[model samples]
Target: MDSFTLNKAAGAVLMVLILTMGVGIVSDIIFEPTIPGEPGYEIVLATPEDSTSEVEPEPDVVPIGERLMAASASAGENVAKKCAACHSFDQGGGNKVGPALWNVMGRKPGGLDGFGYSSAMTAYGEEKPEWTYEGMDNFLAAPKQYISGTSMGFAGLRRPEERADMIAYLRELSENPMPLPGQ
Candidate 1:
């Protein structure tokens, strides 16, 4: 309307436009769109044009079973400490609150003689076949989950390494040693 009012409004609009442009430029400079899966963004650095050598990494060679056993033995010692109250691996090992875990690797789910297995274990035994390495591994990882209604009160081992080592130690109790992975 008036010259003074129109001049002030125009100056305010110009100031706002300048501030917006300045903020946009600063934002563009500060943040890079290099995150993977985000579109229209890439990250690259300049290098010497003559550099042509490629370095290949050595492939992993250990079998899955061996790796699990190694991880188990290392983690098993610590985890088995929790099982020491009712179980023993030394001579004259007897079932306590739980069955003595000798040769449990390939044995049936509830095969221990003279020990009264819980209904859950019995059911699991009826439903499942002999405990292979993978079977035991899965069972130990989650006993209640594996059997659904077993009476073993102990919580299962959650870590892969602990299950591997515990199985390794149990296999050691047998006259024949269990072979490592890929066998």
Candidate 2:
């Protein structure tokens, strides 16, 4: 209310504003990239002496059948949590975002009567008669990549063992479990 008080408050506000601007300016000066094009470091990749030699990548994972032979249904149940949001594993379970996967191992892809499937999935089913072990492996590895234009947004299981376990769990979901790879 007094002139002196008002003047002091105004001066304090101005000082704070100026101090904030000063810190911002100093940080910009210190952190800004010094040179435009220079990465400031070099990445050197080693090359083979014989350029003509073709290199084949060694496979890191064994076949799904081999993995399935040792797969664990209990672990598979845990992995199924990822799919639980979209599919129902119980027999007579209703479809969710994706169809109910109850007894899906031997069933045709996109074959669930009530659930709608993407065109890509329907066509993939036409070409591939049933969800064989290997087919399940490939599809579970990369659904979108395995069947282009598929609507499944799942990133697919990356571990071979996990896929096998998931397949094993799915196998048991059926009233009549399909034979295992060796069985």
Candidate 3:
């Protein structure tokens, strides 16, 4: 391009930039007060325990493994219904959204072949090696928290009894249920 055209283009760009900055400055002055704590809006924070219709509070600090000893497999079956959408408990059950969970106890995380696993879960398997009732219990308590970036999106079984029951049911999925904690 000729120098004249180039200079015109540069001038036009500068004008647009100047106008953009001017608008930004004017908006800031209008939206934000010169003194602090005088913004266009005020933020209201909810006090602790102030929520209406309080939901179930988290259970006690008991170790999940100990809780597993009292876990009811029948109770777990009901919990398993939620899992049924993503996993099949029967032996040789094919992969669904999640891998077939048969014999998952003692199995490596993301162990199933051809079932795509998130990198976090695969890495977790490498770090943890094998699943014990304790590990599984923690994971079931909060799948995403235990293994961030994991493909499993389940929020987790919050109740200790519910988690134990689910674990008990999962134990039955295997031909050999691993020894319960403190057995």
Candidate 4:
């Protein structure tokens, strides 16, 4: 309110600021921090060219047909459960997110009439014609990779046995399941 009171308050504020600065300076001198030349831990990544360790060769890939011989439709039915969310395995089940997979084996890719197919899948169908054991196998392994622009969101079955089982189960969905490969 008055000049004396205002000056005192201003002087108190200035004194507090000076005290804080002085403490910081004195603390810095007393406890000096040693800065490292390199900040954090150095991460050494091994590139193929620089790597000296021997890389193991990939395992021998058994043919899909041979894998199918040992595959069980029951196990495949379980795997197909995931497919059930997108596709209907039963005959006349109709399309869900994906076209009904009833009798998908030997059927043309993008063959389902009612459901819309991706241009990539239509193009793939044009290229491949029908879904052969090998074609289906590859498609089941990686849908997007098999058909680059396909709308299929499924990541696909990574395990060959699981794919074979799924194919086996799908085969059974029809009136006459296609003869298993090598049968």
Ranking by lDDT: 2, 4, 3, 1
TM-score, cand. 2:
0.68
lDDT of 2 at 16: 100
| Candidate 2: segments with Cα more than 4 A from true spot | 1-58
- What TM-score does candidate 1 get on C-alpha atoms? 0.57
Best by TM-score: 4
Whose TM-score is higher: candidate 2's or candidate 4's? 4
Q: Using lDDT as the measure, name the better of candidate 1 and candidate 2.
A: 2
Q: What local lDDT does model 3 show for residue 109? A: 81
lDDT tens readout by residue for model 3, 31-148: 9856667657788865535532212334565776777777899999999999999999889999899999899988998777879999988988888778877777778878876776
Encode model 1's per-residue lDDT on 62-144: one tens digit a residue: 33376464564545666778888977665457888888776666667788887899876876677666676666766676666
- Of the two candidates 1 and 4, the one with more favorable lDDT, higher being better, is 4
lDDT over C-alpha atoms for residue 79 of model 4: 95
Task: List where candidate 3 sits over 4 angstroms from the true fold.
Answer: 1-59
**Evaluation by TM-score, superior candidate among 1 and 3:** 3
| TM, every model | 0.57, 0.68, 0.67, 0.69
**Alpha-carbon lDDT, every model:** 0.68, 0.84, 0.82, 0.83
Instruction: Name the runs in model 4 displaced over 4 angstroms.
Output: 4-59
Clashing pairs in 1: 72-161, 72-165, 73-165, 120-149, 120-150
